[model samples]
Target: MGKLKGEYIILQNEQFYLKGYKDFANERLKIEDYRGNIEHIFSTIRKLQKEDYVHKTIVKCRTKSVPSFLGQGYMLEGCIPGYFLGGDAYFLCKYHDQKRFTSSMWVEEDKQLEEVWKKDGDIENKGVITPSIRKATTLDAKKLATFYASVFPIYPVPIDNPDYVKDQMEENTIFYCIETDGQIIAAASAEINMAYRNAEITDCATLSSHRKGGYMYDIIQSLENELVSKGIFCSYSIARALSFGMNAVLHKSGYSYQGRLKNNCYIYDKIEDMNVWSKDLSALSAGKSALSAGN
Candidate 1:
């Protein structure tokens, strides 16, 4: 995402990614590292809300610390399976603004959520051999930027910039794509958190004409296989709640709906709510898969 002028603090063993004020749609506090007491973290959040007016706060912590945040009025928003070494991770959120917390368009979003929830995680037949999805290298950054620019007028990140895409690849992000006649038609990526053995599947896009061809399913399946090979299988996606196509593809690929983030992101054209979906590929994890087993 585009860097905004926001407070990024690192205190001894603790770190915070406070959502930037310029990105008003996603203004919140994100606790990246919390090795100390819970009260100290909450105190910081309170101070941030009072002085900065952040609309929300999100923290990812182990199950052992869930009660401490919940007692302070934080609600469980979602879970990241296999996020810790041997334990699952949780995302707890507390809202400072009632409007940002409430979903006025829930009724509309509910219909889409229900429809996607019931879908079997199976790739629909498209009557043609699908192009193999490939792992994108830095050489493809410029083309990827051009492709993203064609699909979105605005994004939470400066994805249209080649340097930004290259920088991400150099970091922890991996991009995958489907090509037709030497042209990229659809793409997605996994933002890896190696420290936590987890990744977030995001940045999905497709050419308008190739919508129903199931290219997305291929990309997701490949991404899962890749992560599993890296010994990372805690997969989750933050999809736009109101978008049926994206949500359906994620559900059909074995992700379960955890919860929603109201006014969470500024995507495409406007600020939108996001739905959290996750899948666990570990032996102990339970979920349906549209692709082959042993992910």
Candidate 2:
């Protein structure tokens, strides 16, 4: 991928997708415009790219000063990112290190792996909520911030910014908790990209004492169902590639392994692969529904 004159292009196997902010937004956004509707902008590029090739598509973005929403969630920087579309979903990639250019490109490699543990509906109920699960309200921001601070020391943004999550509390995101005797012990949230028809599972953390008790798994399933009810059928997450406990939970829950974007994020100055994992939640819901009907 390369950017020049305030536009970006990606070349793969002699086929390419390119767009300018002008053409992308029909001249609505100038080069330095701040309010780019990244979703619509990428959809236009994907349309043109498909005109040339039929293979699965992947686009990676490295930039500074991404939209606050993307920045807080994914840690994009320096410039606003260009859009990637048409494969499974769009992702903004954080480069492993700083190069002279703000961005680079990579092929989509993870589509090769098959997933394991297709769960039955019973798996949903099997989640014993020792610390009961509940939807988080705006009032819970401070508590949520505190929980994140204690657990996600590796996150790129300061963990204490209650406003960070506060800004994400619009219709797009649903934050929730696993609480014990009224003290919040664990937390998770799903951000639904209504435009993309998908959900991003993020901010999952449990108190150390609460670990190994399956609360996280229970919370994940519950949140998955919540997204499903709202018509989101696909879910994806970026997590530390080597987090065995999280990987095991996602694995058991039937999320497909889509491989890692090597050295894509920060864990306190040390970079790590933010493993890209996705699940076809629609399939999971359908399978569970069928199993339920049979029972």
Candidate 3:
């Protein structure tokens, strides 16, 4: 994706991605003229569709474009408050593969899991001993892929490939893992956005045998601390909305609810909505002007 008339930036990732094609709101565009701009966007989408470059188009825009997008058969998926400095960001999607974009077992599983989390309080470690948490290295790539494949049938990236995992690690994506008996049982990562002073806490996975442990919370806290120390101001996650354990971990860890992305990703063999949660790391600042400014 490239510039379409110098007003907006189209982003397209040919590589494996869930939300691969999108249009971003740039500074040059007049927000009030979004209706006209959307026509250009639709034209671009049609051109891309004809070439078979994208199966679906996901548009992320400021609130100004919501009305125009809605008028053009796009549906609002979610909104994230303070996603762009002090403003909000909206997610909209128009699918060309509607039949393939339906829900699956993970949807119902999430609902049931959430109910259990609400009633049981924190996720228990059950009888398994707490695993040791540490940063992952390239050597852990194969194990990481295996763990991910065991949990998710479809993920954003090909986590079943060790080479891909290694590339991501080399690109500054930090992976943290919980290990026991010299084996990795759970893992997660912080996708850093240095230019925006934020990070998306994503790619969380654990082996089935390691369920119901507080390892996620521990890993999240550890990642947050690392982010804050490195001058990252915000940490956010798009968690499966139906999963009680993931949502509970974010909630208990002091993250505030933002909104929900409907049919946002293909995971666990189906399309599912994801819950948006964010934590303000700048609030923990100790008189650092840069950190304070981020708040």
| lDDT, candidate 1, at 23 | 32
Candidate 3's residue-wise lDDT over 1-295, tens digit each?
A: 1112122333334321112223121111112112234455556555654533234556656687678778888777666565565456676766666543464644575566456446535556676667778999999999988878778877655777888889889977899999888878888999886645677899987777777788888888788878878887678898987777788778877787676655565567656667778888777555465666888
**For each candidate, C-alpha RMSD in Å?**
4.0, 12.1, 8.1
lDDT string, candidate 2, 134-196, tens digits: 898878888888877777655644445777677778667898898877778888889876655
Q: Work out candidate 3's RMSD over C-alphas.
A: 8.1
Give the per-residue lDDT digits (tens) of candidate 1, residues 79-151: 7666776577788888888877877777889888888877775666578788888999999999999999888
Clash totals, every prediction: 1, 7, 2
lDDT of 3 at 237: 90
Error of 1 at 241 (Å): 1.0
Clashing pairs in 3: 110-242, 114-244
Report lDDT (CA) for all predictions: 0.79, 0.55, 0.67
Model 1 backbone overlap count: 1
Ranking by lDDT: 1, 3, 2
